[model samples]
Target: MNPLRILLLCHSFNSLSQRLFAELRAHGHTLSVELDIADSVTEEAVALFRPDLVLAPFLKRRIPPTVWQRVTCLVVHPGPPGDQGPSALDWAVWRGEPHWGVTVLQANGDFDAGPVWAHASFDMRPATKGSLYRREVTQAAWRATLAAVQRFAGGERSAPALPDDAPLVRWQPLLRQSERAIHWATESTTSVLAKLRSGDGQPGVLDTLWGQACYLGDAHPASAAAMAEFSDAEPGAMLAVREGALLRCTVDGGVWIGQARRADPPDTHPTQRSFKQVAAELFATEAAGLPQRPVPLQRSPDEWGELRYTEHGPEGARVGCLGFDFYNGAMSTARCERLRAALLQVRERPTKVLLLLGGEGFFSNGIDLNSIEAAAHRPGDSAADASWRNIQAMNDVALAVLQTTDRLTVSVLRGNAGAGGAFLALAADQVWAHGSVVLNPHYKNMGNLYGSEYWTYLLPRRLGDAGAKALMTQRLPLLAAEALKIGLLDHNDEGSRQGFEERSLERALALASSYNQSGELAAKQARREQDEAHRPLALYREQELARMHRNFYGFDPSYHVARHHFVHKQPHAWTPRHLAVHRP
Candidate 1:
């Protein structure tokens, strides 16, 4: 293919754009650089370049339609075809997408909507926003530019029109200060870790020390795991230390202290202190925020919405999963109520099987423990009663799954399920887990009840009474294979269950097409049997589970021994578990 003259429009002479310019020049193409595309200079720059094609690698300003029409202006979007917009990289990182790439296409007046040219894709790794761009995206963009150029020059530029059926690429707005508030009482360790990773090496994770804003640097999952395990320490307490690595704490553990500044210097050893000392100080500060008076639960507007489903056939129904993942704070009573409403709306359809297909790697992370703790601390509030009610609300949703008629609810577990999270998956008539998935009731580890309200009912029903007791007491995690053996999961074939529900949905529709009569009666009968079989066990379990939780929290250890480790000059060998067992 013969080389074509190219004009590169970029926001800055940054490393990414600079590299692209070098590659285009090395490919023997005539290249001109336009560093800025302000309204005044854009036209003049385009006219001056007078090249066959204009490529914008990281240009901030939108290219005018006239300029794009005159020259074959192409925009290299760092996302999937439909996902074209500003800050695609940031959004992808925030959403924890596993795949990301660059799409080089015609730059039309409409933001990222343009005819296809070529794309280079890559898998998303555990990387920060800046690191991800530097490693995967920058190189992919360069490759895409060359490919597009080659196709255009070889007279093989075929316009693949954007599909109308493609899902609109969801855009995430820039993170706001309010959104960054570290609500220790509301967020889970996993979610907090993701937030830290998303903001790694940038603005940094928002944290407060002595009411002053502090930025915590990027922490890996393993490091966060260490910190979460020691969460028995007081909120904001540093419990452990990894040498020259991180100070593990309660709320935001595994945080690398990138930069610390205050009106007053933090009282410490001046240099690096042990994890216990850090935890003690931080805990004291957090404890001071607790109200002497009861704090009322401030109700917020219900921010939950459901997908509008449409009937596919006489005996078939289709609802888009839309990739809903219930994170740590997602299981509030308000959200549960909204989910109940949504489930009811979909359950009305004359469908045989209700398949939850999306939310890969997460089913639900269970009720927000932080929220329960917060409500419990409020003055004039019956924290104990509130906690019980919240658990009941969660259990209700699980029980509803068992009682739903006219459809066999099948949970396709594509990732980790734990605590109420695991029970949510178990509530379904049948659970199909991907090979690498894990199921565990982790409440015991967190010093909470064995399982929430549904555990009483669902656990013994699936696993015999003896099995449920063993699981609850041991707090052992079950891998997918083991979970299948224990009857927790019905099917666990890695390949066959890869996209079981989706593939089965297609097959169901085909069968529905040939149905001489409604299969609604059969579905209802099946649901009735399940409800009857489980109702007695669920009631008994609910009582026992509540008793377990009350007992657990009543004897809650106040001062964390791990925090003691950091307080005293103890070796890092004292794991969080050691301290937790000896808690006073």
Candidate 2:
């Protein structure tokens, strides 16, 4: 089939939109992205690109009928057939729907009621709306999208209409504050989680905390063991705090609130609507009084934790595994510092190898734009200051990895890694990834950011100068296998995240007991010494940070503007010509 000139319409170039853009491009379609800022802008895009089809992967507003009627447009809805509205995923999670899906519908007169092109459904996991969207919804949307696109490319004119006996595709309004109100006195742990997870990453669950009204984010059930100690407190009373989250009692059990958004930060301007911050940091005065309960190394993975340490291998040959599961793998200044401290602590252990395991969904996306944006709103803070501090702290972590002359460092990527995160992994002696893992090993996409993370020094060494330059300029996602072929990865295997992690540990243990361990360590030390003698690691760091310092403090505001646009979810005014292949 001939390639179609596909125009992507989205509110913002988010994860799903990016993935769709890349995949459709790879599948031989010419894609040009236009944010749904206004109908006028979209129409202008349509006139210029003259697209054969328009696909809306993520949009907040309706496609203007004028454009939809002129050209074929398909909306990717996060709902099964007969479901309508913007809060489809939110309603599904809140109502505890067992199954969810993605639908490809033609853009007609009605919203989400157009003829069905294709759809893919899956069993819903007990997860937040954000988590569900990233994993299952994204996968389903891609499958359904690809299928529908194939049909359209094959000259199909019309799609199947809704069956007469089909269930009513009732419209769901935006999930509001009232719909998310938490009733601690009457609600159980499950109910509280449903409410919180329903809106985990967006508007958040409207609730009262610290004698003020705010929105609550990520939550997990408190361990029954911990609840035994705080069982006597009032149902809604804040109990304990740990790992940047706060615990609050429910009638039968309890939940931990990881982050919060409030409209009343004294430091922020009154005109500013609200501020979202780590739950612990937002209410520091109240948090200081809460008891601290840290999760031990052997604890279960059921709650919010930024850092965790575990060990594999027997007796004399141990391999340490360190995991940092920061939200969306976006490390803020404090989080980077915390990770640095953990890395410093773990390196002292008597291990032959160390594994850096990032979060389950994302290995890392780099700096925490959300935190930086919030910090910039404070009385004395600036985005540049936050950016500088965050990059420095992240550099410290990478520096520790670079200076590790004793044990071998390995990065086991179980999920996607992008920008600085991808380069951070290159600091390791070996980088391994699971099959489904995707990597975006470039920073230019983020407003020409000259990324630090010792990436300038590490990436070139792994991929060579020309290859590195090409990779950075291409701005595409590389699967694990493709990355391994390009020498960006040491090993790539197909398996579940859990299985891959298990295999990585086993491999590490085996390497720990290998006959070449001593020789390998000596060779590694010699190579490091030679490289240092040639230029010095300090020099590399200084040179890289010098560039990054410019990215932060220099007159150019590109990096700052890009970060602000990202955090604020600002719509695009025009698509980047690089990705707009159909552009003249």
Q: Judged by TM-score, which candidate is best?
A: 2
* Backbone clashes, each candidate: 11, 1
Per-residue alpha-carbon lDDT of candidate 1 for residues 1-584, written as tens digits (9 for 90 to 100): 78887877776544466557655665788767665536456677667657788888877678877687777888888886667667677667777889988889887777787777878888897656755675467667877878888888887756555567855665555665466555665565556556666665445566765565556543433343334455566655444322112343434443433222222246755223311111212244553443221111111122111222324445244422312333322365644665666676667665665665424435666765434444443577644555566666777777677667555667767555667777877777677776545466656644444456466667777889998788787554466677788777887756543365566456446544545424654765665687667556466555766665564356653212222332232333312331112112
> Compared with the true structure, what per-residue lDDT tens digits does model 2 show for residues 415-488?
78998888888889999998667789988888788888877678788889988889988887776777888899
Off by over 4 Å in 1: 1-122, 125-197, 200-324, 376-379, 382-385, 496-501, 504-538, 552-584
Top lDDT prediction, candidate number: 2
TM-score per prediction, in order, is 0.46, 0.91
TM-score of 1: 0.46
lDDT of each: 0.57, 0.84
Compute the lDDT for candidate 1.
0.57
Predictions: Cα RMSD each: 20.0, 3.0
Query: Any runs in candidate 2 off by more than 4 Å, and if so which?
Result: 160-170, 264-271, 302-304, 316-318, 379-381, 476-481, 494-500, 503-520, 581-584
**Candidate 2: worst-modelled 10 consecutive residues by lDDT:** 263-272
